[model samples]
Target: MMKKLENFAIQDFQNDLINWYRNEKRDLPWRKNQDPYKIWVSEVMLQQTRVDTVIPYFNEFTTKFPTIQALANADEEEVLKAWEGLGYYSRVRNLHSAVKEVNECYGGIVPNDPNEISKLKGVGPYTKGAILSIAYNIPEPAVDGNVMRVMSRILSIWDDIAKVKTRNLFEEIIREIISQEYPSDFNQALMELGAIICTPTSPSCLLCPVREHCAAFHEGVQTELPVKSKKKKPVPLQMAAAVLYDENGQLYIHKRPPTGLLANLWEFPNCELKQELNKTHTEQLALFLKEEYDIEAALQPLIGTIQHIFSHRIWNLSIYFGEIKSMESEKLVQVDEETIKQYAFPVSHQKIYKMYKGEI
Candidate 1:
């Protein structure tokens, strides 16, 4: 069972937080309206992305697919194109799938019921709570990392926030003290506090409105209260990529497999180098091209290397420029710059393309 705060303390905390929020909240684009669709888009984009970076993408996305029907009717490729630089391609895919369901089953309206909304493809507990509370003013607790930090500090809860079970603990505490009359402002206030004041490191405790009730602050352990285990270091990987050109000066690129890292995106053909190759990088590229695509090529290394990092892997990429002597694979397409521009390439491959065009 969760520890209960005194009734008077809960009232005081709610009043101070809500009042501070009304006076100090930033004028964000999503805050301009309470449309569930717009709010849902913002929430999805904001995951694992900073607010400043999300603003332009959010603006572009909403403009392109302003309504649930607009998003549902859009081709998956177009949606992926709009989300090209976002890095997390799966989010857009799931969002697209969910929106199609909403359009078909719910008449293009985001479901307000908690159970119904949670059943959507990408809607988790936090997302369901955010939509229900912010869009419909339902008294649901939105416990994101920000909210978790704020609550953990305020109540001095030492549970590991990284563990899935701890989310319920925080959610229960939030449900106990949430402002029923103003659930939107209350949850946003908690998130805002964590973002601006109760930060991950060196929190601004002096400016905190709920400082009086913050047990961690009084106990002098605010920075360490919300315990999270450290993540393992990313595994390093060596990869060889080929920037193949044909007699007609067209570049060779192919789509990735439909469901994995960088799924369905266009990229220069590449292969993982398991260990240090006995041959030169250029020779390795030639052999890989012949073995994988049955294409013979004269290969030379580019002037520099391209290193791209993902969440769990670091790609130490060596790029090679090659002239294709003969073509064999039907899967590989040779296209000019105009045709290439029509396809969405992963950022790592885009770097190679930029180098090919002398842009970097």
Candidate 2:
């Protein structure tokens, strides 16, 4: 193990790695400085999003709110608006709470201590360690999926890397290498390699900076290392998404409840369209919607169909765009632009509604 680990310590190897990074590393705004607030925002935005996809969003976000106080002072809608289309909106909600926690509880100052930051809203172990190392240079390592893969292949560990046991093993090793000197830069280097070179599908060993020290690479088994269990198949779900437009070109939209997947977001009027109805469906659906919500009006034709795939299921979103022919005219309620500007809408709807925003 000691012999294998020396590959990381070789002076030429480390310098080569850094030099390669200096030339190839992306010029992301978040990597420009050690600002904790900016780093926190980047980490949250990059949770499940790719780095390329997150770059513009990070720039827009930082430009909007440069400091913790700015973020805390911003309205919830504004925060969610900034986070639209990025998905997994809870991260933004957690960010809002976390920012407020810093302002109200900590005098609007970012905490220097990792454990103290962890206690704040939405901070987990990985996040805490990241903040500690990057923002404050406390020498704590942040072990995420990328770090796990890089570490497992380097040490040739055969254990299930996804399990808690493997995490513990890596944690001990991390503590050993963690240093007050050059802490954040070191961890970032390891992560950058894992992300770009030692990728999951097709690892570019030839481009890897520290491949000489990687046990999996030396033994020609890099592809098979860091095994994970096969994922379960995604289930199919059904939903009816209705788009209502009046003759004036104004569209009717509804606000989602302030919790769950897309909290406090405006959306097209939608309901779970069960699969039980077949050729005898139209009448049953129209009646159900009427009775269920007082819409009670009959639908005419199917306008469009959208397939929205989420982490768990595939939603066959059947959208019906129709005009209410004035049955009682009570179903449609009038809302002003003030209400429209106060909520966030799911990115899917935003994509669809961009065609209609000007008209509305």
Q: What CA root-mean-square deviation does each model show from the true structure?
A: 1.5, 3.4
- Local error of candidate 2 at 287, Å? 3.2
> Which digits, one per residue and each the tens of the lDDT, describe model 2 over residues 72-175?
99998788888888888889899999999999999988898876898887787778888888888888878888888988888787888768887777777777
- Model 2, C-alpha of 99: deviation from truth (Å): 0.3
lDDT of 2: 0.75
Residue 81 in candidate 2, Cα distance off native in Å = 1.1
Which residue pairs does candidate 1 place in steric collision? none
Q: What is the TM-score of each candidate against the true structure?
A: 0.96, 0.87
For candidate 1, the per-residue lDDT at 177 reads: 92
The model with the greatest TM-score is 1
Give me candidate 1's TM-score against the actual structure: 0.96
